[model samples]
Target: MEGLEIGLNGNLVDAETQQEGGRFFAADASSSNYILLQCKDVLTLEQKEELKRLHVTLLSYPAYNTYYCRYEPTELDEIRALPYINYANIYRPEFVTEAGLKDKLENSDEGHQPPEEKRYEVYISLHEDHRNRLEQIRQKIIQVLGIDPELVNADAFILRAKLQSHEIARVAGIDEVQRIEEIPRLALSNNHARVDLNLEYIIGAANSRLVVGGGLGQIIAIADTGVDDQHEALRGRVRVIEGSRNTDARGHGTHVAASAIGSGNSLEFGPIQGTAPFATVLSHVIVDNAGNITWSPLMFQRAYNREYGARIHSNSYNVSHAGIFQQRQYDGLAQDCDRMAICLPQLVILFSAGNSAPFKNVTSDGEIESQAAAKNVITVGACESTRPMTRNPLTYDYYVAVPIPGYLALNLAGNRDQMALFSSRGPTKNTNGGPDDRRIKPDVVAPGTVIYSAKSSQLDLTLPNILPGAIEAGVPNDGRWSYMNGTSMSTPLVAGCCATIRGRIALQCHNLARIPSVLVKAILINGTKWMVGTNQDSQGFGRVNLAKSMVCFSNHLGCGFWPKQESDFARMQMIQGQELKIRVPLPTANPYPDGITPRFSLTVTMCYLDYPDQSGLVDHLSLKVLQKTRLPDGTFPERYGNKLPGEPADNRNNVQKVIWDGISAPAPFQHPDPFRIYVRVERLARDAQFLHHFALAWHVEEMSRGDAQFDFWNERMPSTDARNRFMRKD
Candidate 1:
């Protein structure tokens, strides 16, 4: 009433709410399509059609002069206003207001406060030619918010409406509102049966038994607590998801869908595969069997009907801790699962990082959980392998339908590559509220202790409190197996080693569906064995090597990308210190001239995906390296005179990485230079594109011999179709 304010289009506009925090929503890049409200006003054109039926456009009737912003834009800080100027730009301050919300909205009551009906759910973002006038604005949002223009959804451009609360200011002053709020009420979701091939020999990939023909035409999914697809290591593979409920009755989604892509056609044990056992499972029950989890009903029930292909989901489940900051409702469901992984380009979502026991990198054990500490989901964590769990064969008589408990065991004692004191450590430091959630994360690590795979003889194979009489209670079991540990078995061994590195880039670089899950998460965190010196919050950017991420994606040795843009300004560029460079050339087909500085060992990574925007604008982007050799008295390499060596005017980290490790060689070849790799996409917060698509990944190698040497370069990969045209590398 008085100075109004509830304007996320629940009407009652005229500005007042910005005293400290935007009650429901608030934006300001010096006001883009204006939004600021205070509600319960003096209204009714059915409350302005319930503020245009909860999709509120621009609301300002008279009380338009209220500005108190020190920033309130979200969906993960793309941070804008550097000079969209207004509130006297004091050192570039966006907006900050108080003075007791301007003397309690200029001293209250311009009348009418009784008329509540409460029922909201909202999340509208329309305006793409108003989605072809969404059923004529869904019959004026059901004749002014009575709720039933078939519940108005507009199927994603963000629109989730449910109305009431006085029909939300008659649907927030619509002109096809580009933003609306309220939708964070998640209801939510483990592991073990084996160390899964001793976690494929602790991430070295079972010493190259590399069945490299991994899950072709990929498809993971698995959500959880339901995958029992007639388990004999999932003989019929599995699909479910349609209306979910394909029953698992708590066998824990058929042993986490046979530990990510299992299909060892079950005898119950030999090589207990999965980790993309020829990938393709979908599953997706969302924790039933009394585990009770609910992520927007299976992400809008498998996005209602169809269209979800290119996936890798596998979220070993965790939530209900919700503390260490970062929550735009789990970063708006991780920016809608990173807009379906940049629109499904080898999509990978993964999520574990929460066995929640140990913690470091400057304290706090209760941090990285929920949607696995959100922000574009990779998470993972849980290293293992000192080798111990090997039980199950006292003259074994393997399952001819179920009987042999023989020695009935599943050991995996933990000690190998270490770091599994429950595995869940990371700097994650606060996101969705962005700026600096520090980022490190469990981007790697694998082999959950005591691992084994596929088990769903249908409940009770154990767990009524570990080994208490080692199971027998009505065991009908079919293709049953055993063992269990955490970081939910190291996130499906990095989602089945990203489907065997996208099945070796679709069998030797034919370009496995254009390989890209951030360049297979930067070639598995730059082919980690440990990002060269651990404790990046307990070994992230380490472990999970998958045979050095399939020989660095078959010798392209760490990829790079920006590719997929066809609109909204193609290459989405906005470089500041300018330099999108690349020069990773060391194994130049063995061209001698060991001319120093070629001791090799580098790791890159870069990662990108942002555009749910609220505006923080320029988020730091960096990665530097320069060596252009020469000097042993031959002149040429100068320390950044015009810039190169560690060049940077900007660097904050979207997912940055840079390690050297070794550097000795230098005896000189009179004129041998070239090691450059500058990428710095700096811009504090001016905007033109808050990093649209980046995926850089690199690896240089040669680290002082004892086996750190990966690709001495050139091992045979490229083989395109229609008779050859592949030659493309930068």
Candidate 2:
């Protein structure tokens, strides 16, 4: 039981003294113990060995080269057998300082600390071999400081370990595979040439009146190819981080920046404007002309370190192969990596899920590395939209479908109907042999296929780059103001949306913290759409429907299924009295401003719990409303009241009840009000389940009034034979 104690300052003492005095064991420097020797100016291995023979174990040395140690009274073999050595220097003075040691010593006052400056005392485990050495070091520190060694405690320090950059060339089964092109021969040339702008869908889904500004007027660091600061869309929005020579020679950075928050006119040719046009862009060009990108976690940290309030960051460029090795020494410089602005809660760093696809094992190399893989950041993926092209040559216009005889489909060419095979997909699985921790990747998807956005004409207009071959393949006239596709293209869409959501939430709720990244994610996921045949993995949640999402949030519509009531109170009154029955009709369809489908069943139930005067009078009245009903003006009312009314409205006379069924609908009902009801209530005040038997019948209606032809409702009809049968039978 004889153990040695070591301190952070390299002081040591015997185990018995440590236990009785209250000192505890701390860290082990055996792996990097040489770091301390070098700090002490012990140059030779022989000198180090000689010092070791003196029974002194060297602890860590501060940056100032101060060496500290403790003496291990027991032999190395004996020390190795002890369960734990007592170390002293690891104790945090803050805890004892903020809350006086006397208070902490009182068992009754254990949890009673000041609200603002609370602290916790902790202990760290040490290897058996290093136990005595660490203990000895602790004692020496107490001796040097001349403090009561017994009062010493230990504090746990978490080391910031950087993960190596992982590169995957392709995502399995998704990348490089040509999506089957359905010939655009609808037989109607007018329809073929004329694209549906679908502006109604966009306008209906989004609330144009609610503008969410992004970020402080402060700067956000964007590591990408050089941004187009001069471009009208990004002109005032961008603030180039000076001192760093990084510039977007490749134009990738510009596209990424534009996607993040390009405010240019949506009417102008090229792609649509970004999600957060009002947010300032801090452009940090990281990609060069040769397609060589020089970036590290350190570079991003340095950029943001200079500006603290810069809460937003977008890194579209990544190194495929750079990460921290487990055995490597990352004590100083590497530890500083966590101090990066991106690591802070206020800053939201977004990265592209990566362009590599079709090979699940491969990704955009460093795209999933630090910062992107960091716990707090948001990662976005791309989704292809089936929306037709908008042609307004005066404002902005382009062909959205493929021209005859072209094989390669470049996004800029305006084929919005297809998804680019290269856009990355993920639930970033554990890559380094460990637990299968799935990093929720691609928080949301956005229009990435054939997206027309601002592009740098400088790169796109040059020779072969914009030649017939390139044009035939669908590359834009120049990289500028051209269209592009990839998760890179998709990520900024979500980032912009995030800024918008954050801004609006902050303005309206005055509760910014309530808007966690997860909620922002929920909005986007809940509004997305799956492709013709893909599942959740390919089209996570759905597309980013900012307008619909904002409305849902405003209305307190959560992601869970809508609440249901077993019985309709309105129908129960009829069964309580023996009176003449009256009929109410139900609507065949739902009526809401927005033509979205209801996902659950609508029902109403009525029960006669108690009989009048204990007479036990009950009646099973089956009443159904005719689908047809007339208003005072003789025109059909929007819906039929589905329930029946009994005369002698007073509660003592008679009672009636009705129950709505879980009926499916093959096609949505056009109108949603004046629903009819069917009632069959038996006298059952004594029966517990009788109350459950009663149901309410009301017409389900859409909430918004806008053009319905262009709505996503076109895709909501039931196609399953079983569901269709259920709907028809009902």
* Model 2 agreement with the true structure over 133-200: per-residue lDDT tens digits: 54554444345445455533322111111111110001001111101110010000001101111111
lDDT of each: 0.49, 0.37
Task: Give the lDDT of residue 551 in candidate 1.
Answer: 46
Candidate that scores best on TM-score: 2
Question: How well is each residue in 59-107 modelled by candidate 1, as lDDT tens digits?
Answer: 2221222221222232111222212211111011112111222232334
Stretches off by above 4 angstroms in model 2 are 1-208, 211-220, 245-247, 265-272, 298-308, 319-342, 359-375, 385-418, 431-435, 438-440, 457-480, 511-519, 555-730
> How far in Å is the alpha carbon of 673 misplaced in model 2?
24
Candidate 1, residue 566: lDDT: 36
Query: Every model's Cα RMSD, please?
Result: 20.9, 23.8
lDDT of 2: 0.37
**Top lDDT prediction, candidate number:** 1
* Global fold similarity of model 2 (TM-score): 0.45
